[model samples]
Target: MASDDEDECGYFYDDEDADEDGVAAFEDDAAPPPERRADYTGFRGGGIGAGIAADRLCGLRIFVCTPNPSSFQIRKGGRCYAGSAAITQESLYTAQKQDLSTVMNLLNIKQHQARALLIHHRWKIDGICDCFDRKGRERMLRDAGIVLQENNSLASGGSRIPVGSAKCNVCFEELPLNSVSTMDCGHCFCNDCWTEHFNTSVKSGKKQIQCMEVKCPAICDEGTVRCLLFGKYPEMAKRFDRFLLESYLEDNDSVKWCPSAPHCGRAIRVGAGERYCEVECPCGFSFCFNCAAQAHSPCPCIIWDKWNAKNTDSENIKWILNNTKSCPKCFKPIEKDGGCNLVRCKCGQYLCYLCGGPTGQEHTWSSIAGHSCNRFKEETAGKSLDTKRQQLQRYTHYCDRFKIHGGSYKVEMEKMGPAVAQRVRLLESDLNLPFAMRDGDWLTRAHRRLLVSRQVLSRSYAFAFYMFGGELRTRPADQATLGVAKNLFEDQQERLEHHVEHLSKVLNAGAPAVHQVENLSKVPVAHVPAMPEAEVVRMKQETVTLAKTVETLCGEMYKCIQDELLPLLVEPMSIAAYRPDGPDKAKELAA
Candidate 1:
């Protein structure tokens, strides 16, 4: 029998029996000898070994095949995994039909009734089934206002038409039986009145119009609505159809429309994961699904919201508060960049920059004559001055670092990105270089990590500003502990910042030198100097090492914030999970 550790590895195979390819194929009933069985204990925990196992397990013969890559898949041991899908306007019907078909098949109901139940329950088919199991099927249908006809003869138009004229309840007018229509609920109304009601409902944007009878819970049949409005108002009928189709997104909890400017006309359906997770739309716009804003992970939605509101116009306001004073006569801000305390505004009002009071025309360089308003007559003025000074100082400290990283990111994207791409092209075209040396994917990956990590670094300053400063503070005792935690966090942040800058410097330094090729218009090819193999290998190793280091640092910083600093807060805060590859790219919806 296999030992416990071997069993934990989840593989029964022998390394010696395998071919030179290193792939151990297992037969259904063939057990390897005890001495020859592979010791796969090293693969028990996560690492390169575990990654290999995951990939290999997918190629096993027992698992069922699925064409849709985003569809949920089951491993041999019953682990379920699925990727998110992008629901576009073209695939909206197909996306909705999956649930509709499931519900219809389970309940043996028509499409209209299934849709009514789904809309009422917010498209949770599993919840509906569970309810049906707990409280019989009839009660579940009735609760969602779904009524089924027991006999065809009892339904509308099933019984013979009335021999004489019938009185319509809505219009109270006598109409021939053929001119009146009876709904599933057995409420009869004149065809004209019913058409007007359907038209009004459609115009009002009501996707599911209820029965016209007073206090009736039954939803109006979609077919009835379409037939009534198609003749007089074809456009309204089209609008009604669209409204019903879009209800899948508007009402479902697991799906959301992409929050892109100018509208991407696509919605994302998350098959798994929390609602707060971040997703990238196929249109190349990434956003936090929870708040429908640009992707800001590792920062809770609430904190991100507060940070955005606080930062808007904050730098300009702080500069005005710290570096300028209002003119005493005109009340317009005047920044004294140079000469003396005696400053003249564009409005022709001369004021003392220090005291912010009007000065006479006759004034010296150092002091404004008869404008000695610097003395604080009241203690209130002294306290106010101190408060403003502290606030300005605190804001400046955080804003300077934030702006630095933000500006660096923009510059790197605009300048270094194209430079790296060009360098990579040059290397690929060099025939003297080996295939491995020609690949520049490491540089591209490192550059992407640099961009994302720099964003996190910039936002971390904002988080620290609000977390430790006056905006949010804990008890006196907690403050001491928080100070220690803050130091630890800053240390990690500083280390990450140092490495990110180093990576940025190396990538910005430009790619390895390629042989200079001088060409003439008449020459088809130009002879170029061969790059040394050692230099090529060394450059490749350095780039790969730096990329891996940057990725590790970013992961560590995220883990530190999630595990350490956040727990110290009094109120609970949640951030989106760290995704090293960046935001989750939504797969195109399957046809």
Candidate 2:
């Protein structure tokens, strides 16, 4: 198996001067000290803020224009040996290329000092030439020997190409029918190989996908994933393409955005205006942009995935400028406000649907996605105080619902608190008083506990179900929530009967004054007639007091929740299991 794995060295860095450790081929003796190296100011203000990596100087063939004292002898086997400073890639390129001997010609670096800085440029810098061409360049970059694929494959972990240069998955051949990229897990079989695999999975009803590379979390690029595989691997390709087409038609134009929120996620979304439907997320967090819930449409946002992907643009700014009026990819309305006219798609696709133009393939939405028309309804929506007021009203509504839920639960639980306390007190009073030590105390204590449990649960249940109007909003009186409330009500009825039974003998005989069961309800007790209006009003007042007691108990529990339980919910998110920062937050609510 180890023999099957490819060597770290590749064609690109296999040159005569190419050192085994890529660093040795590129060290320069005469260079600036680390303290004087230039500070990183983010790549040309393009938003890709990358710092200069110090290790790079040792990896290239360095050339110095002038000699200086900063220059040091190369370390030969840990000892400094004088080696004349080189003036070109050719001289240093020869002495210690592709061997441990180059590292032996170590920089005259001090024990604690950082290595000297030589000429450095990012990959985009022009006129930078390598001894190897493009293909060779990619291959050399692969030899760093560490791959970050999630699935730990027995293979080279998807960082390196498959054994024997990865034949097409379908045809089992080396050359691809067209352009292709290996999965992150280094499963580099041709696209044809994967199309069949997708067909099998999708058919078996698997909705999620990751690399075939063991446990990789990396998702296949959905758009061309099928095309690449099917275009070459005929059998699986045809079946998979059919599935893809079906998916495309039923789908509204969805754009892929990053799932990371206003962060890196560029998921696929669809629709027009403040409401978008059927958003497909690249991070697998598909949900509606409107209502911020899961996507289920006929009622989708209808976003164009190709429109929002221009996360960083240099070459495609003009295309975005031309397509900013309406969405360029779908010819649908784009209602963004106050930005340059760049509208990148969530998917990789980038063409203007409005003028049949193309958007900047990689630009910020603000760069070119300026509002082009006077037609966005959501725009000028708050121009009227009434609309603004309504927006405020909705915000308040959601907040009020949440608060009412908490309050109602607390209030209900407080009612049981006093009952439980009184029962315990009554039991204690009777124990020390001129009365027999009753076994009934055990049953009373249990009843009190049972009451406390019911009180706590009943209120929270009501808040979860009824208070939010989730029950009212649901059809059939919101069966899911209603069922819970109904069950709680029934449980309370049963508990009342049970406690009454335990106190029955004492009630008929008349219990001791210290622990009387006189006023308590019992099944075997005599029947009572309906109360008059005044009596009903009095009863309602009693109910209110009982509710206050319940509320107090609820507050006590909430204190515990807030002080201890909630902190454990995690950071950047509450409850640790829900909300915006949570992984499933996008899918948690219904849109």
TM-score, candidate number 2: 0.20
Tell me how far the alpha carbon of residue 402 in candidate 2 is from the true structure, in angstroms, after superposition.
Answer: 25
TM-score, structure 1 vs. true:
0.64
Residue-by-residue lDDT tens digits, candidate 2, 1-591: 122111111211221111112122123422233332221111111121111111122233232211232333221122121111111222221211211111112221110010001111111111122412332322322332223222224222223433234455446577632333454344454554566566676566442345565554444433334444445544554454344333322221222333345643233323211133333343454454443444322111211121122213433444334433444555564542211122344444453322224755543223446522211123433666585454433333322322333333343234333343344444344433334432234434333333333333322322222222222233443456445544444344333322322222122122222222334345222232223345333433443343334334434443333333223222211111111111222221111
Q: For each candidate, give its TM-score against the true structure.
A: 0.64, 0.20
Tens digits of per-residue lDDT, candidate 1, 354-451, equal 45667765443323334333122334334646776666556555665565567677766666666566556656776677776777677687778878
Best by TM-score: 1
lDDT of 2: 0.31
